[model samples]
Each structure stands twice: as C-alpha cells, then as structure tokens.
Target chain A: MNEIMSILSYTFFQRALLCGIAISFSAALIGVILTLKNYSMIGHGLGEVGFAAIALALALNLPTYAVSIPIVIIAAIAIMIISQKKGEGADLIIALVASGALALGVIITAFTSGFGTDAYNYMFGSILTIGSADVILSIALTVISVGTYAFFYNRLFLVTFDESYAKARGIRVTLYQFLIALITALVVVIGMRMMGTLLISSLIIFPAIIAKRHTNSFKGMVFTSVFVSIACFIIGMFSAYFLNLPTGAGIVLIYMILSALSLATTKLLKL
Target chain B: MSLLEIKKLNVSYSNHYALEDIDLKIDEGEYVCLVGENGSGKSTLVKTIVGLKKQDSGTINLNIELGKVSYLAQFNLKDLNFPATAKEIIMTGTQKHGKLPFYSKKDKEVYKRVIEQLHIEDLQNRRIGDLSGGQKQRVLIARALISEPELLILDEPTAGLDYNITQEFYKILKQLNKENKLTIIMATHDIEELANDKPRIVYLSKKVVYDGNYDGWKGYEK
Candidate 1:
C-alpha cells in the first residue's frame, strides 16, 4: 500500500496514467471502424512506419514525436491510396510496406553506436519516460479525435456499412476514408510511446474484437470497446508498477486475458 | 423532364468493353427493369447510373437534387456478419436528409414510417446478421427507401432469395412504385417473374438489344 501511494505521488506515473487512458480511448474509437472495415492490419503497418520514423529521429537527435507523427501520416495516406486502386492486393501491399519500414528502422539502429538504450526503451516501452510534452500533445489529440468522431459518426457509419450506397447518397466516401486513416495514424503514433511499436497495434485490435463479441450494434460495439480499453490500460499500469513488468507487455497481456474471457463467455451464451 | 439521363455512356474493364454507346432516360415514377445474361453489363449500367462506376465518355445528368438518389447493392453472403442492427442500418439512409451530425426528429419519423412500410417492426432491433435472407432484404430495401429518393436504383436485389421471398420482395417494390410513385430502376434476371408488372424492359448484350415493354423483349436476340 505504501509503495502504491509513493508510485502515485510521482509525476511520471501520473503522466503515464493520463496518457495511457487518452491513447486507449482514442485507439478504441478508431479501432472499431477499422476492424469493421477489414482494415485493422493498417494499424500494424502504420506502427512500423512510426517505428522507422522514431529510429531516424533518435539517430539525428531530433524530437521523436515531431518527426514520427508527420511521416506516419504520409505513410497512412499512401497506404489508403494504394489500397483504393483496384486489382492490387491491399494486404500484400501493406505487408511489403510494413516489412520495408521495419528493416529500415533496424538498419538505422545498427549504425547508431549508442542507440541501444533508446532503442530498447522504444521497442519495449517505459511508462516512466513519458515527458510533459507528450502528455499535453496526447490530451490535445484525444480531444480532436473525440470531436471528429462525434461530428462524423453518422456518415462514418454509413460508409463503413455500405460504401457504394453512401457514395450514391452523396457522402463523399473518399474524404471520409482519408479522414479515418489520418485519425488512425495519429492515434498509433502517439500511442507508441507507452505501448511500444512492437505491440501498439494490439491496443487497436483487442478492444474492438472483445467488444464485437458482445455487442450487436455499431454504437454498442464502440462504447463497449472504449470502456474495455480504458479499464485495461488502468489495470495494466497499476499491475506493471507493482509486478515490475514492462508496461506495454503488461497492458497487452491483460488485453489478451480479457479477450479470451470475453470470447469464452460469448460462446457459452451462444451470442 | 427525365429524372435521370445517360447519353453516349461507355464503361470498360481493362480494354474489354462492358457497356458501349448506352443511352437511357428514366422519368419520375417509371418502373424500368434491365435484363441481360451474365457479363451483359446489366450490373455495370446500374453501377454507372448510381455513380459507383465512372463512365469512359458520356454524360449522366441527374435532374433531381444530388441526395435524392438511393441505391441497393446486390447481396453478398460475406456481409452477413456485419455487426449492426436493422434499425441502425436503416438509420444510415437518413445521412442524405441533412448536414447534421446526427439524425433529427424528422429523420426519426421517416425511419418509423419506413419500418412500418416494410412491415419490419419486429426486426427493427434484431441484429442484421441474425435475420433471415428475406428479412435482411426487406431491411436493405427500407434503407434505400428511407431517403425518400426520387429515383431508387437496385442491382439484383433479390439475387439469392427463395421463390416465395422473391415474390414478397417484388410485391413490396411494386407497391412502392404504384402507390408511392417511387421511380425504380432494377437490374435482375427474373424476367418471367417480373412479367406481371409489365415494366419497361431494357435488354442488353454489351448494348441495348431491346428497350420496350417486357412483352417486346421476348423477340429480342443478341
């Protein structure tokens, strides 16, 4: 109990809690849409691009989020464009891009002699390392994300369900598609600080899948996903502080356990 | 004035022409059925009209307001697993009604009317994926109708339905056309079943072979 109180008193722990909650909520909102559209893998692919950007930023002594965010946005748009072209396999294209970015990141890290500690921190994530700048940026982005989602909720629902019909109804399908990709890219980049590049995409995938197993409506799925993500993040952070486990892996393992329980319960109930 | 006009329209799929020199005009409240064999471009023509497919060289003049058009795509079994309720799916149709981020009171009224019109009140709260094929088709039709579109385009809406369900489906469409005067342009292969309506039939095999009453299509040959 004393240890818990002392941990909570630290500014780093408070920042991690705030950032983790915000990121998890933002990721849940974007994740439900992507998972339903069958574009969940794009999160993983864009995370790789963010990883490359972060490595490059570190090697050049530049601000990490400043460099990584813009590059991830560009890569996200590129993926959307490439996927939109007919007759081209979107999954294959995403795979090639993801692998290429991972290799680039690895090669850059190799050249930087003193990159071991920074690279390790990025790959596994350290909640104690989150700075005030990250906290402010994360909170601002979360607000924008929530606002965009609220304003475009109906239109996004239409596009996700029947894009062709949405187009016929004059919904500007392309614009909304790019908007979703952009929002997802932003969330993935900001989230990489605490979740790590290796497992960040899981935050986007697990919550949606677990909620989908329980909810039948789009609104229900989204609400359930956000709730599940926030709960998992808080519990994972606390468990990591007490158990001395890596924060990212701790959160992801909790997500896995929750997802397994959700799956089993859904099957038992025949839902 | 015609509600929709397409002139000199051409659509191709990688150097192979799917439709060429297609000219079509549909007036308000007209019931037009497009019939053709597989690869005859029946689907292509409807898709082009709905703005899902770009025309190679032509003009598609929609006389009505832009949002006054609605489409019901062909059913694919893969979409059966979509996590949405019938009511939620139907509510999406109201997106064309206004610029608001959410549905208004009027939108909700229209939704209620659509549910009653389609006799899908029981399925309103049911998950779409859990509904039967016939029930799902009615939900989709409701989605298309809730927009109150002057022109409703359907691409093989009854493709995989059973015989009785197909009959029921046609009945609802006929009621909408005759009673509500909703202009409907449908593409389907069920010519004999649709013979009772005496709808204008456009038979195509890469081009319009016949564009007249259904009885006239019997003599049409590619």
Candidate 2:
C-alpha cells in the first residue's frame, strides 16, 4: 500500500493525472462539435499528421511540438480547403493524405537507429513518462481551446447547422471553419502526448458520440461530453494502474463501453 | 435601374449544363416567381445569386451588392431534430456577423423588430425542430427577412406544405411583400398560387423558356 501511494505521489504520475483530465475535457467538448458536424475523422487526420511531423522532428532531433506545429497546421488547412466546394469525396482525400503521411513516418522511423523503441511510445502513448513541461503545455491548450469555443459558441452553432445559411447571414463561414481547424489541430497535438496517434481520436469521438445520445441541445452536448471524458480518463488511468495495462488502450476501451451503455440506455428510454 | 442583372448565365455540374444563356433583370420591389421542372436550374439560379453556388460562366451584377441579398434554401440545412428555438433560428439571421462575446445591443433590437415584423412573436420560444412544415417555412423566411435584405430569395418556399397552408403562406408572403416593399424571388411548383399574387413569372425547363407576367405566361397553360 505504501509503495502504491508513493508511486501516485511521484511527479510523473501527478503530471499524467492532471494533463489527462484536462486533455480529455477539452478534446471531448470539441469532439461534440465535430461529431455533430459529421467531421469525426478530422481528429484522426490531425493525429496522423501529428505523428508524421513528430517522427520527422525526431529524425532531425528538434523540439517535437514546435517542429510539428507547421505540418499539422498545413494538414488542417489542406483538409478545409479541399473540402470547401466538394462533397463527401473530400473526406477520402483527407484520409489518403493523412494515412500517407503516417505511413511515410512509420517507414522513416523503422529505418532510423535510435527511433526503434522511442517511436513505440508515440504510436501507443506512454502516460508513465509524462513530464511537467507536457502538463504545462496541455493546460495552455485547454485554456485557449475552451476560451475560443465559448467566444464563438453561437456562430459555431450556426455554421454547423448550415454553412450557406450562415454565409447568407454574413457569418464568415470560411473564417470560422479555418479557426476551428486550427484549434482542432492544436488539441490533437496536445492530446497525442497522453493518448497517442492511434488513440487520440477515440478521446475525441467516443465521449462525443455518447454525449450526443444523452443531450438535447448543443450546450448540453458540450457539458455532457466533457463530463464523460473526464470520468473516463480518471477510471481508465486507475484501472491501468491496478492491472498494469496500457493507459491509452484502457481509456479507449472504457470509453467504448460507456458509449455502448449510453446508447442502450437511450434506446431503453426511447430517446 | 435593375436590382439584379444576369447576362448569358450558364450553370453546370461537371459537364452537364443546368441552365444556359439565361439573361434576366429584376427591378426593385418586384415579386418574381421562377417555375421550372426539377433540374431545370430554378434552385441553381437562386443558389448562384446568393453565392452558395458559383456560376460556371456568367455575371451576376446586383445593384444591391452581394451580401445584401438574403437567401433561403429549398430545405433547412439543419436536421429536423436539432435543438434550437424558432427565435434562436431567426436570431441567427440578424446575429450572423456579430459573433461570440461581441453581440451588440443594436443586433438584439434588430432581432426584436424582425420578430414583430414577421408576427412570429408567439412562436419565438418554440423549438424550431418541432415546428410543422408550414411553420418552419415561415420561420426560415422570417430569418431571411431579419437582415432586411434588399432582395429575398426563396427556393421552393412551399414545397412540402398542405394545400390550404400553401395558399395561406402565399397570402402571407403577398401581404409581407406589400407591407415591407421587399423584392421577392422564389421558385415554386404551385402554379395556381401565382393567380392570387400577380407577380412577374419566368417559366423554365432546362432554359429560360418564357419570361413575362403571371397572367401572360404563354409557355404553358395553368
């Protein structure tokens, strides 16, 4: 018991606990917006882009997040630009570009000497190594993301419902779309540290999907998603601790289970 | 001077032309109805005018400028189950440009005026997702009008309403047009509704087949 208590008292575990909760809250709120707008894959696309840029940064041995910032931004901008006038087919282009980048990164990392074991931590996040700097970065991102969402809440709502209607009323739909993409990219970057490239989107999607079933309004959806995400993060982290399992997989599995339960409850209640 | 002028307008998807060589002019405060078969480009024209769809090759010279023309699509782009009140939907019109944390008092006043003007005061608090088809149409129209646009464009405004509701809607539109001096352009399937409001009519079937007054539509008998 003393050993377990001491482990929890360690700075690494404290950083992981704090950053994990904040990341899940921010990601889940944004996720509701993405899910409602049917842009669930945006997070996935961003995760792939983040992984590629991180791999490139590792090869160059640069500050990983700083080096990857421009790449993720470019990927996000490309996704928005390509999808502007096109239909669902644009999603295909986004997926292709993102997957190609990730695959390229994987190949590069595989060929590199030092990137062998280090790359696995990124592929599947290792929350055990979370540092104070990562925690500070996550806190900053959470503040920015949450603040921006609150500021543009109504306009975002209008754009989500109908871009044309929003434009007709002079909402600057393109500008808002660009801003959202940027923020989503930033969230993905931060979340990648805790959840990793493969599991980050689950942090965004599952909480949102479950909250959507239980909520009636956009505001309700946001609150519900944040709550679900925070709860899942705590439970998944503790469960991973007890079972000596991978934290990312544990969190995602718990999210999936919760989502399924939510769906079933909605059905039972005829919602 | 014409409120709107289109010269040699052509619309297409990929290679298939939807409208061809369409030249038309709308005067200020003129109520115009576009009657056309499906895919004949009635909705396409309105969409182009409102900047929703780009013209493949043509010029839309609006004396009123682009954003001053408000447009309502054939159907609400939002899902029917979306949780927004009628007032909130209508507010989207007036508050479009006034994004978060910057909503001015003047914008609220504009919304209040529009609510009063549209006579939807009673229905303001009702959830738009729960409204009937006719009511939804009215709410959307009210939203378009909230901006006080120089030109109001509606695509198939009464497409899904009951016969009686459609008639009543046309009457309301006629009254609103007269009272507000709103320049109204709409694509409608109900040719009979044109009889009550004697607006200028354009008959189309993949082209501008006819353009004249409602009573003098010579392309087809109503």
Candidate 3:
C-alpha cells in the first residue's frame, strides 16, 4: 500500500493515470456509438492516420500536435467521402489507407530520424513520459466528445438505426454522421498518446463489445462500456506497474481478457 | 389535382433500367396497390417514390412535401439486429421532427395509440431483434402510423409471414385506412391475396404496363 501510494503521489504517474482514464472514458463512449453504427473499422483507420501524422511530425522535427490536427481531420473527411461512394467498400479502403499511411510514416522516419529505441515505444505506447499537457488535452477532448453525445443522443440514435427514416422525419443524417466522425477523429488523436496506434482501436472496440453482450438498450450499453473501460485502465496500469510490463499493452490485454470473461458470464447467466 | 405526381420517371442501376419512363399520379386518400412479378420493377418503383433512389430524369411533386411520408421498407431492407426496443423503434418515427433530447407528450400518446391499434402493446418492451417476423412487421406498421403521415409507403409489408398473420395485418391496415383516411401506396407480389379490394393498381415491369381499376388488372395478370 505504501509503495502504491508513493507511485500515485508522483506527478508523472498522476498525469499518466488521469490521461489513461480520460482516454478510456471517451473511447468507450464513442466506441459504443461506432459499434452500434457498424463503423468500428473507421476507428482503426483514424488511429493509424493520427499515428502516421505524429510520426511525420517527429521525423520533420515539427510540433507533432500542430501537424496532426489537420491531417487527422482530413483523413476522417476523406474516409467519410470514400465510404459514401457506391461500391467503395469501407473495410478495404480503411485497410489500404491505414497501412499505406503507416508505411509512408515508417519509411520517412527511417530516412530522416534513423532507427531509434523511442520510435518503438511510441508504436506501442509509454506512459512513463506522458506530460500534464497530454492529460489536459485528453480531459478536454473527452468532455467535448461526451457533451456532444449527450446533446445529440436521440438524433444520433435515429440516424444510426435507419438513415432514410431519420431523413424522412427531417433529421439531418449527413450532419449527424459528420459530427460523429469528427468526434471520433478527436478521440483518436488524444487516445494515440495513451494507447499508441496499434492498440488504440482496441480501446474503442473491446469495452463496447463487452457492454453490448450484457445490455440490450443503447443507453445501458454506453454506460456499461464506460464503466468497464475505466476499471480496466486502473487495474491494467497498477498491474503493469508491479509486473514491469508495458502500460498500454497491459491495459489493452486486461480489457480483452475481461471482455471475454464478461461474454462468458452473460452466456452463463443467459443475459 | 393529384397529391403526388411522378412524370417520365426513369430509375437505372448501373446501366440497367429498373423503371423506365414511368408516369404516375396519386390523389389524396387513395389506397394504391402496386402489383408485379419478381424483378418486375415494382420494388424499384416503390423505392424511387420514397426517394431512396433518385430518378435519373423525372419530376416528383408532392403537395404534402417529402417529410410527411412514413415508409415501411421491405423486411430485408432493415437491419434487424439493431439494438432497440419495439417502442423505441416506433418512437423514431416521431423523433425526427421532435424537440431535441425529449419526446412530447402528444408524441408519446400517438405511440401508445398506434401500439394499441396494431395489437402490439405487449411487444413494446421487447427488442425488435427478439420479435418474430409477423410481430416485427406489426411493429413496423405501428411505427409508420405513429407519425400520422400524409402518405404511407409499404414495400412488401407482408413478406416472410404465415398466411393468417398476413391477412390479419392487412385487416388492421384496412381499419386504419378507413378510420384515419390515410393515403396508402403498397407494392406486393401476392396479387391473389389482395384481389378483392378495388384499390388503384399500377402494374410496372420497367414501364407502366397498366394503370386503372384493381379488379381489371387481376385479369391481365391471369
């Protein structure tokens, strides 16, 4: 208990903890919406885009956040436009765009910055060096994301269920869709710092899947996902501290394992 | 004057014309049944009328505006696994024009009335995914009624149901049509089933083959 308190009292550890919680809360909320809308793959693409933009910033020695904002938003808009075209095939487009962007980022890094140990850490995630600025950004983005969701809850629900029905009833399906995509891009941007590019999408998908297995209503699913995500973050971070494992990977693995167990529990109880 | 007009409408899918130069006009309160065989453009015409697919070159003028339509698309058209209750699903019909984040009491009352009218009050709490096929169709119909739409469009409203349940649904539809004087346009393949009622009938197979009395159209099909 004394050791745990000592770790918690450190400023860097406190910032890392706050950043992790904020990322988890926002990702789980948006993730439930994405899972319900059947757009889970978009998160994968957006996270990679944000990751690549950061890599480009690092390689060019520019402010990473400055270069990242426009690139991630553009990527989100481009994916939305591509998905709109008939036969564009969302899964293939996202996969191709993400892998291609990530590859370009790596090639640039190799040429400009040389192979470095920190690059691999960034690829996975390192909570050890997360600053207070990162924590504040995460909190601000999470608040904005969750606030938007609260205000547009019903509109989003209607649009996700039936686009034509929503349109007929005079709901702006396109507007809601764009709003959702925009928030998702923001979440991906902030989440990349805590979960890294590779495991970040899992932060958006796993808890939502667990929540879905237990609940039958949209509200129930969202709240359950948020709760599970927060719990996983705390447990995973503490366990990683003691086990000398990677913090982000530990959190992701904890989420995945608990999600599996939740699924099993729901089945056992026939929920 | 017609309440809705479709003049020289043409709908194509990747170079194949699904509906060709089709002209249609429906007056207010007319119960029109669109009949045809499979791949005969009946579904395409219905879809075009509902604005799901835009016509390549045509004009669709509606006196009641497009927002007033309540469409019950083909069963296969909806994603059944969607996470919502039957009542919640039905409530979406009213929420489009509703005030944000809350449903009005009048809207709630209308929903209640529709559920009672369609005998689906028991299924209000059930997930739409959990309902049987016939029950799902009934809930969809309830949803269409909740909005008190000026025009109700149904695309195969009775697909994947036993004969008794289909007839029961139409009987309920008939009651609502008479009580509310709601305009209805339905497309169905079961010509033998709806042959008795003399609703306006439009037969289309990529073109307007016939448009006149319903009873006379049945002879052409035979």
lDDT of 3 by residue, B1-222 (tens): 898898998889986988888889999888888887788898888787776777889888888966678898756525454667887778877735443556788988888888887888899877778888788888888888887888998888787788988888778767767788889889987666775556788887888898988777867768
* Candidate order by decreasing TM-score: 1, 3, 2
- Tell me model 1's lDDT, rounded to 2 decimals: 0.86
Q: How does model 3 score on DockQ? A: 0.41
Query: How does each model score on lDDT?
Result: 0.86, 0.80, 0.80
- Candidate 3 predicts chain B with a TM-score of 0.92
lDDT of 3 by residue, A8-80 (tens): 9988899999998998998888888788766788878887787778878888789877898789888887887
Model 2, B199: alpha-carbon shift in Å? Answer: 1.7
> Considering only N, C-alpha and C atoms within 3 Å, which residue pairs clash in candidate 1?
none
Residue ranges of candidate 3 with Cα displaced over 4 Å: A84-88, A167-170, B77-81, B95-100
lDDT of 1 by residue, A1-271 (tens): 8988998899999999999998899999999988888888887888888888999999899998889988999998888888777546667777988999999999898888445877877777889678888798789878977887787888888788877777877778889888888888988888887988888888899999899888888889889999999999999989887889989999998998998898789788886
lDDT of 2: 0.80
Candidate 2 accuracy as TM-score: 0.86
lDDT of 3: 0.80
Q: What's the i-RMS of each model?
A: 2.3, 2.7, 2.6
In model 2, which regions exceed 4 Å deviation? A1-9, A83-91, A94-99, A114-116, B7-13, B16-21, B56-59, B65-68, B76-85, B101-130, B160-162, B205-209, B218-222
* Per-residue accuracy of model 2 over B1-87 as CA lDDT, tens digit each: 899999999888887988899999999989999988888899888877877678888898889866578888767535665656787
Indicate the residue-level lDDT of A96 in model 2.
88
DockQ of each: 0.59, 0.39, 0.41
